[model samples]
Target: MLRDIDPILSPDLLHALRAMGHGDEIVIADANFPAEGLGPRCIRADGSSASDMLRAALSVLPLDTFVPDPAHSMAVVDDPDAIPEAVADFQRIIDDTADHPARIAPLERFAFYERAASAFAVIQTGERRLYGNIILKKGVIAP
Candidate 1:
């Protein structure tokens, strides 16, 4: 086991994160997401919940600051303004990882799928709850 890595980050997940350039996106998705048919690559944190997996990923990867909406979550159906409890959990996780609160964009279902399709990779989690998916953009570390 690597001393510094999150145990959930298998070699493939590390490779995907390493391959990503600044601003490339990754999604830590709910169990119900179609992770298999998505992304050029997929990694399974088979026993972990999406939010837990997301928290682990954030322990390593940095969020992109080049874009305004570096984080994204699915919007409540038919109520774009409503924040799901799962999304609120995501906000808190990001806020703690970042220095301040993250301004996450609530994407419509289809928009979220589009973003997922283009992501560098998708980390599919075991979370069974609805609206548990989250997207993160990769950021650079200053040299």
Candidate 2:
């Protein structure tokens, strides 16, 4: 038990977050996401929702402020304008955690998949919410 560390964050998750460099991305994905084949390394939180896992990650990981879009979520299929309820909750979670209203950019399914595959690692959560997948770029903690 480390001081102030969320128990939800396992050694693997903490290691991945610490090992990631500025601008390196990580994905917190839903159960439906193909995370096994998506990331070079994967951390599984089979019973947790993507938002829950993401909140836990944000508690420890800093979001890259250097980039215009440090956060991304999968867009509703066949409708770019369609925002899923899960995404709404995701935005709320991010807003509450990050305390910023930076818009969550919507990505096409294929683009999201490609991005996730290239991320440092993907955490697969058990979230049953549709379009719960989200990606975050790591940032520097200014001294």
Candidate with best TM-score: 2
Q: Against the correct fold, how does model 2 do in TM-score?
A: 0.94
Query: Taking the tens digit of each residue's C-alpha lDDT, what string does model 1 give over 10-63?
Result: 888888888899889999988899988975478888799887887778887888
What's the count of clashing pairs in each model shown? 0, 0
Q: By lDDT, who's the top model here?
A: 2
Cα-based TM-score, every candidate: 0.93, 0.94
lDDT of 2: 0.87
C-alpha RMSD of each candidate structure in angstroms: 1.4, 1.3
lDDT of each: 0.85, 0.87
Which stretch of 10 consecutive residues in model 1 shows the poorest summed lDDT?
A: 95-104
Which residue segments of model 1 deviate by more than 4 Å?
99-101
Error of 1 at 80 (Å): 1.3
lDDT for residue 116 in candidate 2, whole number 0-100: 90
